[model samples]
Target: MKAYPITTRYIKRGEDFIPIIIDAIRNSGIKLEDGDFIVLSEKMVSTAEGNFVDESKFEPGILAYFCYYWSKYLWGYALGKLLNIKEEKIKNLRKLPKKETLRHKETVIRTVGLRYALKPYAEGGLDLTNVPGTYVSPLPKDPKKWAERLYNEVKKEFGVDVVVMVADTDATYRIFKWYITALPYAINGIISGIGVLGFLLGRLAEIFKVGGFAGCTPLAIAGNKVYKNYSIDQFVRIAFICDRVHNTIKNINEVLEKYNSYVITEEILEKLKHTPVVVVKIKEEYIPNR
Candidate 1:
């Protein structure tokens, strides 16, 4: 399989994503063909759809405060021991900033639910890694529809029929053929929700053998005949390869620090080549058996 990262200008809210994707493909100089898969970061889609929350506008409730304190001070050790989380991460959890952490937790509870707000980061696929301060991107409301739309739009504009997969950077755990993730919503037959409890159980299951953090979560897939029989492991492996190529910068902080800006300003984004879309070529021989 061959993967090509398509670089383009930064995407903004309410902007038409199909055009941006077309521009990226043109600039990358890679011609699309039948059976090709287009992998897009969920953040890119969310941002384009204006699916984000500004934490400053919301008030932290009592439940949010309690959960934050318990996770940081008490629950961290228990979960750490159970899941074999790194000592460094456990220690960092204990030192979470009070004000900001509360705000984040409150936002999570309000948006997704308490079950999801309990996770450490990327709760219910609500991500803060790529966005600026006080701003978090929520998972697309209708990922399947988004995938279908993108697939149809690509076919209309480029005249090439291809599969579209929207994915998240969050790692999914695998136990044999079963894929488990802590995300609140279900995707591609993977079990979700149960939050930190799911992480613990998945790790415990791994102790038996052949299970652990696999790769990026495949949130939605549309088009293509081969994908119908794809296993969770296959989705993860391909998604990981696609994610590594699409990320131009390491994290949002790096971009902020580079430009000395609070948010992802137009100037900073314009200065860097952003690769949000990736073309993945899948050979028939490379498709893993279900």
Candidate 2:
């Protein structure tokens, strides 16, 4: 199988994504054919649909305060150490500020419920990586619809019958064949919304082999018979690889420096190759092996 990262100019709110996808395909010089799998970064779709929140406006409630304190003091120092989490991450969690942390926790609680709000960064698929300022992108409300729309548009534009997968960059834990993720839903056999307790349990039990970030909540897979049995490992590998390609700015610090407004302007984004779309060409002969 081969993966092609399609580079395009920055996608702004209210901009039609279909045309941008067509342009990216044209620029990549890759011919679309039947059964080709198209993977899209969920952030791009969310941004286009204006599915973002101004985190600064959130007001912390009692539950949010408790959750913040528990996560920072208890989870960060005790549970985190028990789970063997990275020392740096543990330290960062312990050092999280009071007011800001409470606001962030509150946002998570309101967005994905109290259970999902307990997880680490990118809680409930709310991400702050690419977007500027205090603007955080949430998982698309209806990913399956977007996937179907993209598939239809691609067929209309290029006469190609391809599969579309919308994915995020949040981590998912797996035990043997069982895929456990923080998101509430998944397309394959992935168990979702297991929360922080599940994450810790999975780690302590040593059942998790690949603990890296998986795709987002509501991963939408449309069209193509080849993806019927696509495993969790395959999805995680592809999603993580594609996510790295979508990170136009090498790191968060660079993103902040380049776009002080926090919102990446079309002008600045145009100069960089923002690859939000990836085309994964699966080899039919190796389907059984995969």
* Off by more than 4 A, model 1: 75-78, 86-88, 248-273, 284-290
lDDT of 1 at 245: 80
Put down candidate 1 lDDT per residue, 1-290, tens digits, no spaces. 87878876778765768877876686777888888999988878888788989988889999889879877866467866566776766776776767777888999889888877777655778877566556888887777887888889888878988989998877788877778888776575788866766666667777766788787788889986768777778788888888888756554445545775445544555577777888998873445459
Error of 2 at 19 (Å): 1.1
RMSD, every candidate, angstroms:
4.1, 4.3
lDDT of 2 by residue, 1-290 (tens): 76778978778765768788887797788988898889998878888788888778998999898888888888787977877777877876786667667777888888878887787555777766566566677788777888889898898888989889898776666655566777766666777766665566557556344443343333878876677677767777667656655646643335546665444544665677678898877763323335
- Give the top-scoring candidate (TM-score): 1
| Collision pairs in model 1 | none
lDDT of 2 at 284: 33
